[model samples]
Target: MNASLLLLIVALLSGLAFWAGRSRSLVVAGVGGVRTLNSLPFYYGSLTAFWCALPSLVVIFLWSIFDGVFIEKLVHPLIAPAVLEAAHGNMDLVMNQVRNLAASHVSAASVDPSVVAAAERLNSLENINRWAQAGVALSFAVIGAIWIWLRINPQLKARAKVEDIFRWLLFSCALLAILTTIGILLSVLFESLRFFQRVPVTEFLFGLEWSPQTAIRADQQGSSGSFGAVPLFAGTLLIAGIALLVAVPTGLMVAIYLTEYASPRMRSLIKPVLEVLAGIPTVVYGFFAALTVAPLIRDLGLSLGLDQWLAISSESALAAGLVMGVMIIPFVSSLSDDVINAVPQSLRDGALGLGSTHSEVVKLVVIPAALPGIVGSILLAAARAIGETMIVVMAAGLAANLTANPFDSVTTVTVQIVTLLVGDQEFESAKTLAAFALGLVLFMVTLGLNYFALYIVRKYREQYE
Candidate 1:
């Protein structure tokens, strides 16, 4: 049987187990009163279903993982030595040709007779494997259902057992997340260490120049590349600063208006409209930045005759930062509004009783009460701006210029990482390893921001609480 059909059969069997278990419990209760049962009928049903399905699912998962390896091993001996030698010991390529021949994806005239025989063997093994998997899985599932069903009684603590299983499932999910994070960190750290062995960490951190083009062959011109990363760091900060300048005040003011002054009807209409900005893809925002915002900024600069003192490129950090700010406005506004609303109304009332005006109450009481959450929201928006790649790539030219001016073209660390790893590049090269090093730095910077945000939150939260 196919995997999907097997899954359907398992589902049907589990459902049958649930029905049988529940009906049995109800019948037993009808004879001996409901109070005799240790758990609810629903729990008993769920416990039986779990027992029936869990073992079979494990079998299916384990079989699916190993089936391809077993089939490949079973067919490898059928390929003639000459055909295997021509494949250069690449078992994956040999298997690919075998599959293509078996499926008639490759013409018979294009491949060797030995390959054709190997393909036939592979097909036969696959068929046998599928049948064996289905048979074993179904038999185990049926046996599990019968054994568990026989154990079900009026005194069975089905609810306790089921809840314990769910608790472990939740713990496993949390453990998976932690392990995934650790894996990412370790991978980046090892790659960055490799990069640093070739390029000095001090130069990467403090050097002003930002060239990373190390040629693969010595004959290539410009092969002796600089590894300084200060320009990229400066560009990232310049754009992110502009983004925070645009986003923080605007988003906070909008949140204030919605929470403090706007009517219920106006809030209902305007909030959703504002939040719609967040749903637009970052690529779309990038297009708007490149096509519209960048050109507009350049034209505005020329019209104002500021081109003499301030040179604005068609692609500038200002445009990308502005578009990114617009994209994150809803994130800030929505979070801030929720936080502001969570402030106790009694604080406002108490401030008002002291002869304070609406503005005074908001400034002294409401804002203080909501300060920690507002700080968190702003930090979240700032992180979004820093991590953005599409807008920077589209609106800002990839010329890692070390300048404070927003009108100057610049690139971010993420854009440079992508540029370094864009093609079929060898991972062993310093160029590719540089991407991981850049990622490590970005990760550390963001982690520091989160820690600082937490510190600020805890410091102020104690006062308000």
Candidate 2:
């Protein structure tokens, strides 16, 4: 049977087991009623259902993991030794051909007779494996159901056992998340170490140039590639700084107005409309930046005669930063508004009772109370702006120039990472390995930002609390 069908059968059997366990508990109570039982009928039913499902699922999972390996080992002997020799030790290639031929109804005449025989044998083994897996899983499910059903009694302590099992499941999930994060960090760190071996750490960190085009052949000119990352870092900072300048004040003001001044109806209308920006896809924002905002900025610079004084490219940091700021405004305003609203009404009233104006009360009482969450929101928005890829790729041209001028085109670390890993690339090359180094640096920078934000939060949170 197929996995889906097997799962459906198992679910149905578990449901039946739940009913049987509940009935069995009631019978054992014997006219003293459910109050005589050590646990409730619900707990007895749940315990039976858990037993019926868990063991069967585990069996299916293990079978799926190892069945293919077993079958491949069995099929290996069917292929002729001559054919195996001709495969040049590429067992995976020979196996892929066997699987493809097995999947088709008519075997190709051009294929060797021994390979055809192996394909037929593979097909028979797969069918047998499926039947064996289904039999084992179903048998385990039945045995577990019968065992739990017979054991259900007044003194079983079913509730405690069920709760313990659930607690262990939650712990397993938490451990899985931690292990996954550690795995990612170790993978990136190892690859970055390999990259640093090829290019010095000092040059990667401190060098000013950012070209990463390594030549494939020794005789190629102008493609030896410079790996200085300072230009990319500078561009990233410049654009993110511009975005923060646009988003922070505007978002905070919008939040303050909605919470402290706007009518309920107006607040209801405006908040949802503002938050809709967050739902729009980033690629849509990219299109707006490239097609509309970039041109408008270029034309305005030309009309004002500013292009002569400054380098104004069609794709500039200002356009990307502005659009990104708009995109993240909802994140800031929504979070800040929630935080500001969480300030105690008693605090606001006490400030007003002391003869402070509404604005003074808000500034001294409400903002200080919400300062930690506000800082957290701004930090989140800054991270969002820094990590944005599509808008930067579309609006900010990939010129890796180390300049503070917003009108000049520039590139970011994310864009460079995308550029480096765009196609089929040899992992051993310095150009490809450079992407991992960039990722590790970016991860460190973000970690530092989180640490600083937490420090600010803790310092202010103590006084407010």
Candidate No. with top TM-score: 1
Worst 10 residues of 1 by lDDT: 216-225
lDDT tens string, model 1, 290-330? 99999999999889887888777889999999998889998
Candidate 2: residue pairs that collide: none
lDDT of each: 0.90, 0.92
Q: Give lDDT for model 2.
A: 0.92
* Superposed Cα deviation of residue 450, candidate 1 (Å): 1.4
Error of 1 at 276 (Å): 0.5
Question: How would you encode candidate 2's per-residue C-alpha lDDT over 1-465 as one tens digit per residue?
Answer: 899999999999999989998889999988899999999998898889889988999999999999999999999988888788899977887888899899995565867788899999999999999889999999999999999999999989989988997998899899989999899889999999999999999999999999898876568564767999999999999999988998999999999999999999999999999999999999999999999999999999999999788999999999999999999999899999999999988899999999999999988889989999899999999999989999999999899999888988999999999999986556688999999999999999999999999999888882544
Instruction: Name the lDDT of candidate 1.
Output: 0.90
Q: Cα RMSD for candidate 2? A: 3.0
